[model samples]
Target: MGVWGFLKTQFVVHLLIGFVFVISGLIINFLQLCTLPLWGANKQLYRRINCRLSYSLWSQLVMLLEWWSGTQCTLFTDQETVDHFGKEHVIIILNHNFEIDFLCGWTMCERFGVLGSSKVLAKKELLMVPLIGWTWYFLEIVFCKRKWEEDRDTVIQGLQNLRDYPEYMWFLLYCEGTRFTETKHKISMEVADKKGLARLKYHLLPRTRGFTTAVQCLRGTVSAVYDVTLNFRENKNPSLLGILYGKKYEADMCVRRFPLEEIPLDEKEAADWLHKLYQEKDALQERYFQEGTFPGPQILPPPPAMDSPKLPILGHPPPLTSNLVCNWYLRQRLPPLLILSFLGFMWTASFAVRRLIGVTEIERGSSYGNSEVKKRD
Candidate 1:
């Protein structure tokens, strides 16, 4: 094995990396707790603080994906979508086909400068998990139990709470409601057949209640729905473990933006619109599998990627102060420079440690479950 591959297989590296992730995450979680008192004083300020705090936690995975693994994402979308990204509230509809799909989505969010403000319609159990789950809890991510009766009021209120959100946010939803698997596909297709709906070969039939409810609750706040289809180019089986191993895979994502105004406002009509949208998503996946690319001219992801500082390591270091400037000038510039340097260094230090570390199931677990849609407790 090559030197990089050899280091990835080592254990001490993973432990130190995990220690940093777990410890720093706990610290950030505590910091989020400290922001609770500010909420009553200024709701918007509290949200702004949480958004930034959320980024420091979430970007580590993006760092691993981009810097350590060298994985890159190619976007297939019209220039209008590219132009509008990070400027408005959007609902991201993604297919749950691979473990790293969420990472890929977050990479896009980071590129667009909204990673700090990203939200999700996650299951409630996910909130109890460490790091990521805890981070989401503070970021005001809406949670569900998948039972419409029990979740209806709670889920609606959670989504409605975001209507007055002060920052641009991406609400990620996996309408498939579960990861794709051969058995699940068989069952999902069976449901589609029973309902007289067309079958989807690559994706499962969408669960529409959550989608419709979210659109209805966030009507005045959300601007558009981003219908995203993600697929690997070389039939690679992507997993968090693979990333930890420093294996790279190119993710091709085709995004189609649909304005909320055009979607049918009526519940039944809205559900029908969602179903039709999924059918189109299925066709996109079908085409991708056949041709190895999405239909539109591929739009490369926005540049100046969220790359970690290379160890020797990681940023645009501030301009040096001339000796001619006195102690006052040094006081003004030194602290911020020192702070950025320390933060950037620790950031790379942690990830370089991960380069040596290994992955556990928990380290690699999905917000949703693996291989099935069964609830996590």
Candidate 2:
């Protein structure tokens, strides 16, 4: 590696980056908190301001993943879906596997113009996290305790609150409800066996209550449900550490859009639909492992006997749209502030409380919503 490349990997440099990320995030969170007073007076205006604030904070992480780390995010869908990406409100069903998957999703959201306004059904505990979690408060994030009985009412109402949101939004749902792990996978398949649902090789059983409820609450407002399957190229599972050190990794996401009307309103049918979707997701993962791409024919060299014709390569997949994302992020203003404000004692802006494991991304190895987490419910 050259001088610049070597610098990117240094711990001191990473600490500098982390310092900027943490401090700027807190400043943005403070701004988001300031918007709370506008809630009753002008709710729409409050939401708009909070969205931008949220973007300011979240996009810092996206910056690390896109520019600072130079990660490539390749999307596989048709032009039609691409055209509609930032145009309409969508509920994104993202598979939970890699630790940085949400960062990748946010990178896409940043490119599509919805990064600030993006939403997710996060667990209740994240609300206490300093920057990201606190920002979620004003962003109107839906939080659940994972108890069906206790969460049903509150989660539905939270979803209903977004019916008239001012900006086009993308709400992400991790239906598996947690990160995938070996022990959880075994238990999830056992639950699937009992429920007679199809066993999934690469995912935990998707918990459907949250997904169906979100659809029911946001029916008229949301235009489509984006079924997204994410995997890293070469199956190299990625981490925030890789991003912190500016390591380059390629991510492939297969997105299939389903019109909102197609999802049945009846709760039972919707649950079944989510289950069926997971089955198809399983097949997609299987295909990705078998072939290096999603459910599509591979581009290959011609047979020796008939070498005249060959398939053309798609635009250099080397680092497709993320460069565009990085460029757009370049246009933003706060990142320059991140550079100038790096000299302060950053411990006050520290991500962890120093007493416990703090922040969601930091706790990727912890079983946040797994079966053990279920016992708390």
Candidate 3:
């Protein structure tokens, strides 16, 4: 293998990358915490600052997927569907079939200029994880315990908090609840049989509680539901570790937009609608397996130059100049420098701390020796 390829396989490289991510993430999390006082004074400005700070941390993982792993993600949907992607608030329902699915979602968020502000309905345990979890706490990401009774209020309140959010956001919901595996799929299908629901060959039955509550709470605030189904070509199961090891894969995401008004307002009806959506998503996956592509007309590729406008889509919104400037600075220039500075500062602080501790130990040892000498004399 080439030197670069050899380095990619080494554990040391992954450790260093992870270490940097954690330290830098914690730094950004601290900065986010510092914005708490500003919340009451200038809520919108506070949100904007947190969004930029979020981008600083999240862009590190995006860089790994886009630059280090060399993964190419393609969006397959009509231009009309995603034209207002970054400009509007939407709930993103995605299939949980891959470990790196969240990262894939983040990549799309980056494309749509909402990476920093993108939210998710994540598991409660994730709230305790360091760095990423701490950051999410500041981002107001909804966390659920997977128990309907326990999560109902928390989920609704979290969704309600976003009603007056300053920037556009894509709230992600993995209604499937857990990552897909054959064993879990089998058990889920059995439950579907017991419930007399349609059998889903490619996906587990979606938990509708979260979706229904989010829709009900965010009613006027969220415009549409983006039903996003993602799959990796050739790799039936893609893990985060594989991405870390520089595995290149092609990801296809098929997004279908549904107006929030069209989704039933009643809780029961909303739950049924989510089930039907999952059934359709299952059918799409079946088609993908057979055709090796999504069932849609391909949008023309954007120009090779980074500065060129992205591919045209239906109902595209005019670019926001402020957002564009923020995107450029955060995505392109800031993350790397911020991470490197954090690493340097951490290293220097650790060295200083160790030296200080050593000096104290040496002084104590000398004092003890002098005491012994005086006693002997």
Best by lDDT: 1
Instruction: Give the alpha carbon lDDT tens digit for every residue of 1-377 in model 3.
Output: 68887888886565555545555566677888899999899988888888877776677677778777788888898988767777789999999777678888888887777878899998886677666778899888888887788888888888898999988889998888776766667777877999999999888888888888889888899999999999988745665666668888889989899999999989889989989998899889988898899988665323222311222220112222223433454565457778688557656544433332233231221231132245557
**Stretch of 10 with least lDDT, candidate 3:** 307-316
- Cα deviation in Å at residue 38, candidate 1? 0.7
Summarize candidate 1's per-residue lDDT along 175-258 as a digit string, tens digits.
989777776788788778999988988988899999999999999999999999999879887777678677889999999999
After superposition, candidate 3 runs with Cα above 4 Å error? 300-377
What is the Cα-based lDDT of residue 98 in candidate 3? 72
Note the residue pairs that clash in candidate 2: none
Extract clashing residue pairs from model 3: 79-314
- Preferred candidate (lDDT higher): 1 or 3: 1
List RMSD in Å for every model shown. 7.8, 9.4, 14.5
lDDT of 2: 0.75
Task: Note the residue pairs that clash in candidate 1.
Answer: 13-356, 13-357, 14-357, 14-358, 309-314
Which 10 successive residues of model 2 have the least lDDT summed? 301-310
Whole-model lDDT values for every prediction: 0.78, 0.75, 0.74
| Models sorted by TM-score, best on top | 2, 1, 3
lDDT of 2 at 214: 91
For candidate 3, the TM-score is 0.79
